[model samples]
Target chain A: SAVISQKPSRDICQRGTSLTIQCQVDSQVTMMFWYRQQPGQSLTLIATANQGSEATYESGFVIDKFPISRPNLTFSTLTVSNMSPEDSSIYLCSVEDRGEKLPHEQYFGPGTRLTVT
Target chain B: DQQVKQNSPSLSVQEGRISILNCDYTNSMFDYFLWYKKYPAEGPTFLISISSIKDKNEDGRFTVFLNKSAKHLSLHIVPSQPGDSAVYFCSVSGSARQLTFGSGTQLTVLP
Candidate 1:
């Protein structure tokens, strides 16, 4: 398991503003992902960030709104652009610990709790 | 639509008793299933996992039973301890190996 660190563990931002969350892994990994857990909801995949490529967004998610960047294998960033109150939720970053056959059973970060006002 | 579902929002069991948490998935293509434990303000931790080929898998005091035909699975914890009180999430892995998690069931171990 990798120790994943997320910056700004939490934050409160004004509506229409953006918040960029940072995720750093202790060691190099093959893949990293971003997930969102809205209030009283299940975790939803936002995108898969791979080094040297544009993040692949899931259905109902857009790169323009949730831009992701993985400059290297051990670090990635998710920026919630033009945020709204509805975007308030826990944003988590995870890495696939290839050691498991379930390739993407991710080891998650502490997560960034975002509250939009 | 929720691909994975842990319909039971919460369950309570007495300590030292067996606690059973159930989960169901709509996707039959998921070949691997896993259980993750989550504590408040913390990320989920992997607990146990089972492959579709097997009906059950056990680790220490925790056991996972899968019913492939019914798209259902369960986690059985025998002699449950207070430390077992937490939200349990069921996840299924697709070919991509990306895990799809259930809503989660909060387990409370009563003394």
Candidate 2:
């Protein structure tokens, strides 16, 4: 299990502005992921952040919209650019334990709730 | 398209009773399934998981049942508690290599 913390627990932003959410893990992780969740809806995978190289984004999502940065093994940031009312949702970060023997070992951060006005 | 689906939008269960939440996946390539619980203004916490090879897995008060043939899985909580009142989400991962989530089911454990 990992303890992950995200900054800006909740924020209200202007429609054209952007918000960058930071995620820090207690331990170094191999794979970090970003997610977007609407109210009372399931989470949607936005991208995967590795230490180096570009992040792998999912379909219907683009880097220009949600750029990710993973400078080290224990930290990552996700920026939601050009926010709109539709982008008002919870942004969460998840870490996948690489060294674990099990195939499905992952943990989530507290999440950043962004409400665009 | 939505690969994972939790049909129920919300469920109410009596405290100390059994609460069963079901999920279904459309992709046959999915080899791993997981359950997560979430509270307001928080991330979804991983609860339990089951491999495609197993039919059932249990830990303490939580039990996960998977049926590969029907492409269905379920989480059962025995003697549900008030603290368990939260939104539960079901997730699946397959050749896509990324986890796909389903619409969560809000479980209200009423005393």
Candidate 3:
């Protein structure tokens, strides 16, 4: 399992402000993903961040709103732009670890809890 | 529409007993399934997973059973512990490589 960490464990921001969440992994990985967990809802994939490439976003999410940056294999960031009360949720970062003998597994970071007022 | 569903929102079980959590999916393209456990203020942790080729997979005290025909899967924890009190989520992966998660089921193991 990989050790992943996110900055700003919890934060509260006013509407119209942006918050950038940083994700760092202990080891290098090929794929990193961002997810959002709304209150009373399951996790939703926001985008897939690959090193040296533009992030691939899932449906219902656009890059303009949730921009992702992956400068290298072990680090990435997700910025929630123009925050709104509806955008309040827990943002998570995950990395896929493909081992040589074991099956591939995804590990997650303790998410950043963002509340917008 | 919700492709994955966990009908039960919460469940309470006694320690030393078995705890079963069920999940159903509507998409037939999903061939990989995973279970994740999460506590308050923490991210979901990987627990167990199963492929479409197998009906059941076991890791220690945790077992995951999958039924392709019913598009249903269940996670069973034997001799439940109080520390296992957390929310469990079922995730499915198709050809897209990304996972789709079901609404979690909160499992409370009471002493």
Candidate 4:
């Protein structure tokens, strides 16, 4: 298990503006992932951030809208650009803890609640 | 198409009773299934998980049962407590290692 924290726990922004959420882990991790949970909806994976590579985004997400930066093994940032009311959601970051076995578990950060008005 | 499905949007159970949450997946290639609990304004917390090779896995009061043939899985919480009230999500992952989540079930444990 890993202890994770996100900055600006909750924020309200105007539409067409942008906000960047930061995630920091207590320990170094190889794989970090970003997720979004819309109101009354399931969590959707936004992108995967590795220490030294370009982030891999899910099908519906684009880099221009949600750019990610992984400067090191312990830190990553996700910026929601040109926000819209539809983009209001809780964004979370998770790290995969790989064990010697087949099943690996992920530990998550508390999440950043963003509301666009 | 939605790969994962959790039909029940909400469930209410009395304290000290049982709470059951069901989930189904359309893809047979998925090898891992997991359950997560979420409180308001918080991230989803890992509850339990089971591999495709195993029929069941237990962790404390939470147990996850997987049926690969039917592409179904369920989570059972015994002796539910009021603190257990939260939104539960069912997530599945395949070889790609990215999780696909079901639309969550909000469980309310009435005291």
Candidate 5:
């Protein structure tokens, strides 16, 4: 299992502003994923941050809106730009712990709660 | 379309009883399934998982049953405790690294 942490555990930001959330893992991982959980909704994948490569984002999400950076294997950042009320949600970071024989298991960080005003 | 679905929005069960949570997936290609538990103001915690090759997997008080033919899975917690009250999510993954999650089911264990 991997231990993950995120910065700015909870924040209240004004609309039109951008907020960057940092994710750190105790152990180096190959895949780091960002997710969003809106009120009363399931977790939605935002992007996959791979070390030394550009992040791969899912459909309905764009780079300009949610830019991701992975400088190293153990750290990554996600910036929610031009925030709106709809962007108010819990943003989570996860790391995949790959196994030699079995499939990888994802460990998550305590999410960063963003409430846009 | 939602690939994963948890029909029950919430369930109430008495402490020490069995708490069962069901999930369904539309994608037949999903080969891996997992369950996660979440509390308020926190991220989802990994609870248990089962591979499509197996029909059941057990871990202490929790057990996950997978039915590939039906495209359904369920989580069962025996001797449920009040601490078990939390929202549970069901996730499925095909050949990809990313998982598709279902809308969670809130489990309330009444003491």
Candidate 6:
């Protein structure tokens, strides 16, 4: 298991502003992902942050609206661009560690709670 | 459309009793299923999982059962404790390994 942490655990921002959330993993991992959990909704994956390359965005999510960057294997950032009240949700980062027993198991960070007013 | 579903938004159980949470999926390609527990202000923690080839997997007080034909899954916790009160999410993974999560079921283990 890996220890994951996110910066700016919670934040309040006005609409039309942008906020960047950082996710740091204790160890280098191969697969890093960003997920958003809207109020009363399921966790939806936003993108797969590729180290040293552009991220792969999910359906209904675009790079312009939610840009992602992964400069290294242990660090990544997700910035919500031109935020709106509808974008208020909890953002989480997760890493995949191919353990001997559980290859697909993923460890997550203590999400960032964002409120867009 | 939601590929995975948790019809029950919440469940309450008495302490020292059994707690069961159910989930269903529309995707037959899902090969792995997992259960995650989440507390307020914290990330979801991996609790248990089961493979499509197996019908059941158990870890201590937690047990996960999968039914391929019915496209249904369930998690059972024995001797439920107040500490188990939290939001439980059912997630599934396909060949790509990207997880598809359910809407989550809030379990309240009353003491």
Question: What TM-score, computed on C-alpha atoms, does each candidate reach?
Answer: 0.97, 0.96, 0.97, 0.97, 0.98, 0.98
lDDT of each: 0.91, 0.91, 0.94, 0.94, 0.94, 0.95
lDDT of 2 at A71: 96
Docking class of 2: medium
What's the DockQ for every one of the candidates?
Answer: 0.64, 0.78, 0.81, 0.84, 0.79, 0.84
| Candidate 4 local lDDT, A1-117, one digit each (tens) | 799999989999999999999999999999999999888999999999999999999999999999999999999999999999999999999999877765677888999999999
Residue B53 of candidate 4: its Cα lDDT?
88
Every model: iRMSD = 1.5, 1.3, 1.2, 0.9, 1.0, 0.9
Q: Give per-residue CA lDDT, model 4, range B1-111, as digits (tens).
A: 889999999999999999999999999998899898999867888888899889999999999999888999999999899999999999998998888999999999999
Tens-place lDDT per residue, model 1, B32-61, is 999989888888888999998999999999
Q: What TM value does model 1 have?
A: 0.97
Tens digits of per-residue lDDT for model 5 on B1-111? 999999999999999999999999998888889999999977888889998899999999999999988999999999899999999999997788588999999999999
- In candidate 6, position B11 carries an lDDT of 100
Query: Residue-wise lDDT of candidate 1 within A10-116, one digit each (tens)?
Result: 99999999999999999999789899988777788899988988888899999899988888888999999998899999999998887746434679998899999
Against the true structure, what is every candidate's RMSD?
1.1, 1.1, 1.1, 1.0, 0.9, 0.7
Runs off by more than 4 Å, candidate 5: none
lDDT for each residue of candidate 3 in A1-117, tens digit (9 for 90 to 100): 899999989999999999999999999999999999999999999999999999999989999999999999999999999999999999999998778633367899999999999
> Residue pairs in steric clash, candidate 2?
none
What candidate 6 gets wrong by more than 4 Å, as runs, is: none
User: By TM-score, is 4 or 6 better?
Assistant: 6
What TM-score would chain B receive for each of the candidates shown? Answer: 0.98, 0.97, 0.98, 0.98, 0.98, 0.99
Number of backbone collisions per candidate: 0, 0, 0, 0, 0, 0
Better of 3 and 6 by TM-score: 6
Between prediction 2 and prediction 5, the one with superior lDDT is 5
Relative to the true structure, candidate 3 reaches a TM of 0.97
Runs of candidate 1 with Cα error greater than 4 angstroms are A100-104
Model 6, residue pairs in steric clash: none
